[model samples]
Target: MNKNKNQYINREISWLSFNERVLQETADVNVPLIERMRFLGIFSNNLDEFFKVRYATVKRIVDAGKTGKSVLGGEKAKDILEEITTIVIKQQSKSLEILGAIEKELETENIFIIDENEVTDTQAVFLKSYFMQKVSPGLLTIILNDLREFPLLKDTAAYLAVKMVLINEVDGNENKENKYALIEIPKDIDRFVVLPNEGDKNYIILLDDLIRYSLRHIFTMFTFESISAHMIKITRDAELDMDNDLSKSFIEKISSSVEHRKISDPVRFVYDKNIADDTLSFLMDKMGIEETDSKIPGGKYHNRRDYMKFPSLGRKDLMYSKIDPLPVKDFSFEGSILEQIAQKDYLQYTPYHSFSYITKFLREAALDPQVRTIKLTVYRLASNSQVASSLINAAKNGKQVTVQIELQARFDEQANIEYAEQMQAEGVKLIFGVPGLKVHSKICVIEREENDKIKRYGFISTGNFNESTAKIYTDYTLFTAYSPLLKELNKVFDFFETTYKINKYKHLVVSPHYTKNVFIGLIDQEIKNAREGKDAFIKIKMNSFTSYKMVDKLYEASNAGVKIQLIVRGICCLVPGVKGMSENIEAISVVDKFLEHTRVFIFGNNGNSKVYISSADWMTRNLDFRVEVGCPIYDEDIKQELVDTFEISWNDNVKARMFSEQQDNAYRKNDKPKLRSQFAVYEYYQKKLNA
Candidate 1:
């Protein structure tokens, strides 16, 4: 097929549009004051990762002198790079404006985010003591002018570029020599330092400003006429470059790659717009940064991602009210959870439902005498993960526990490597995953002996088995003792051990072999139903959708009169609502307090519906490169509940942005009452519990 350029959005451009939605949260009036500031932080953090990974990839293509049109969704790689920089610069400027408005509103609430210039004498005394006692111990300062080679700047670490006009003359001439230095911001310290509260006001100082205030103290030995400091940061390419060293273990290779990322090629350089021209040029020249590289001019602060951890100041009124996680309806914590699942299927929707259910299940498996074996896949886990502890506990209890932990989970390599070593040390048999594919599936199956027969019980999820993220990331976990599905899930684990042999799954949708074909078959069925004048529709919720083949298939379905609704949270390359191409398709993205991380696919199979919760999106990597899983919803009640939740998100009038060809992330508005899906989902589950 000859692909048209206008048929789809470039993936990089779509990603920027998604980040813009996050930036919009900072400007929302209805959003809580402190939460808005944190949204700005989230936006900044998302941009850093974009540059480190996506932007870096395009830069590589440009460096290779390749057009890269076929891979980049019909756009040249060089053009995409330029477009990304332009879009990012504008978004950075807009974010600053939003930050300004949020600060003004915060002042009205008796909170002040004062900088170094605004520090009072009383605050100065407090700051100086805090700096000496807390900051000075960990601060890294480098004198740059005298060294022949400039020190390597850490990626994403903000630094203060200090330039001082020295008092002494240079080379016996009248010219004064300039001394330059770089001070690494101490990350161990809190970015927002809350000062002692006065009568009715709260004061907080950013760590950047506190360091700026202490520049004189930091350079007390040097005598200079004047001094100034500006914030600068560099983002490096984060792609892991694994070596072919037969002598090294897989863990060693991943650790080496992670360590190498510290000095990888720089993809972006951002500096304060108000910085001295001489200072900016000198630093760039010293670092060998070229004009062609992405150099973004920004406000005073460089790493605004720190704002994600902005102090709450005990102001419950300035943030969204925390919702207590509800118990899954009809699934009690009392007695054996395994016994309960053996009777019927249950779905645990996290944040709305307690994550403790996962931990509870694992802990039960670890202690149960009948449980003989447990196997699962590990992608990303929380720091001090209870999941890891439970796995270790299971292994220590003499149960044969096998873990296929992916050590290359992007910026999580080091953490996973550490967890892998810990689990291996505690007698958990470790599988490093298939050589060519990262195991991204979230599945667990335990074999328990009952009446001379081995009964299998398992759970499949749309998110990682991490407790910390479960509080804010909305996902679905299906607990079932159905032997048919559990048997196929065991086949997935078996594939991890023997990569060359292909496995067939009759129940669970396994990726890298069957997912694309299965989903295509499902879409084809819907297309046939629409042609037959039968009930035909499709609903999907995912983090991203960039597979062009799938987009074309959806377009074909839409052309055939199949009604399609998509809730994609990020990087949707498919252009929805286009006339002739996708007129019957509509898509929306919801960004609110909780991240919409679940991936659910519902297809109207003539009057009956087929529902699935998947670990994968329709992205190319997920479809053909990574090992992913999508399990069908067989239980009638659970399937209806999944449909109900997707409907709530689909009908969200607030916090939902429509995806269109214009790429302007416009919020969906209507005469109908405002319904925030995140809050409404909680209420839906609450009523279920009450019933």
Candidate 2:
């Protein structure tokens, strides 16, 4: 590795380190027992996707016989694959240990997760009946011993690989045969099978165990001497390969790509290492997998992602209490949202604040008699999205409604395609996307008849408008009536419709056109201020930072004696605290109860600061390749709130880890009292509601 290589951490490795911080949360004793278990689920879920997308990409590069060192940030694709396997093994072992600790704690709380071996008579009866009623119908089983072809395994679904030691009786009239089979756990059913409580003791069994209990019934005809079962999982490449055929519609292209992804070549295979050697060999041979494939040896259970749906079982103390989403204090729907927007800008912080205000704004425009046109861009939406419904309703009423739906939003293609078709059917003008750019900007604009002239009002956000996700994913939506900015926003929509022309943005920072220049100009401002002996500093919080141009710009600012603080949640490439290099820059990553997702960029422009919440990060994909927006926080109160939130996150002692080249994930050490930022953020919003 060279100096520049040492200056930056590998993006994929940095991402795994970020997930390791999540795993740390599960092992953290301070967290509530059940919540820690949920953290394990989160860690597992994060790992699954990392393999599906990131790891799978590396494997492809390796398969194509490319070293891929430059793209992988100084690590060869093959080397990164081996590193991922090793790190994942360590993390998996840690997770098992954490699960054991959590189970011990649960027992202390009179809640037990019993397995097949530990199931009581009553629990067994309950599981048997449940299996017959619910699980049996959905169970897809195959006799592996006799089949000419091994069954294709679905990615993300866990399966039980059974090895049946059938006793072949030499009966003169009976034909005997050995048997082995596989039973896939149904994704439609709940993973946690809760049983009838016995006096204060609440018992839970995994769906896996319940299946184990019903194995005899599944293979009754075969007289098995003994049976052993273990779990196995696989993750495949998720990159969609779109056909360049002009005859195919965008929706058809997306449909075909989504279908193709299901059968994409496997990137990672995880199985119980304790599995019988014969059984393991049989599986490897049937699946046509070679020893060169990433065959990871794991423990008995896989697909811990199912724990995301772990039942509450009315155990109120075991889970975090639901924090009711607060209303945007001054913004209301009784009157025209446009009128309120015409006066000043507003910020809507989600989960801690209601997302309904966004829907309500669109709904009002859709129903209002005075509204003329509505235009917006959608990256992702809830399953039964009211946002899409309102747009459809607007179209039905003969109002102009335009939606630029991003069909390339990773893993959400089918949903976006479905919404696109539904909106098109309702007469809404649908923009597939900019020819080469994914429209990731969360923006909405409404034009209405007021004062005998057309007026504009709307908002921009740093995340998707999906209502279900809004409750968990922290994001910021800015509602504004600034005409200059609104006019530029309108121009952005026009640019989407006419991709051949690019419009100049004066106020709003738009990507693939102006974002990089604007950001670099802002950094130069800080560098100039530092040279002038003025107060110069920059504070930024984003999900990921991987753009080499931006990183070099930050380095220039740092070398010019400007202070930089970063609170990144994932994939940070910039190294801090290096002598004469990034000594002025301090970077920390905060991983806690709530996902630190909202992207906030605060530039110390000689103390006359400019703050922006953007849907785009500093990554190359977000800057030059996607249609993303970064809206300035014009509301004084909202700007101060953003500053305070950033400060609080920077002050996090608990759940905050230093981003360093060592990848140690060391918790930020401080003499100050413990402050978990997410909990504090919730209280901060709560106090605002009380005030």
TM-score of each: 0.99, 0.97
Range of the 10 consecutive residues with the lowest summed lDDT in candidate 2? 169-178
- Candidate 2: deviation at residue 103, Å? 1.0
lDDT of 1 at 351: 90
| Pairs of residues clashing in candidate 1 | none
Off by over 4 Å in 1: 1-5, 169-175
- How well is each residue in 321-346 modelled by candidate 2, as lDDT tens digits? 78888777777767877778777777
Give candidate 1's whole-model lDDT. Answer: 0.94
Best lDDT among the predictions, by candidate number: 1
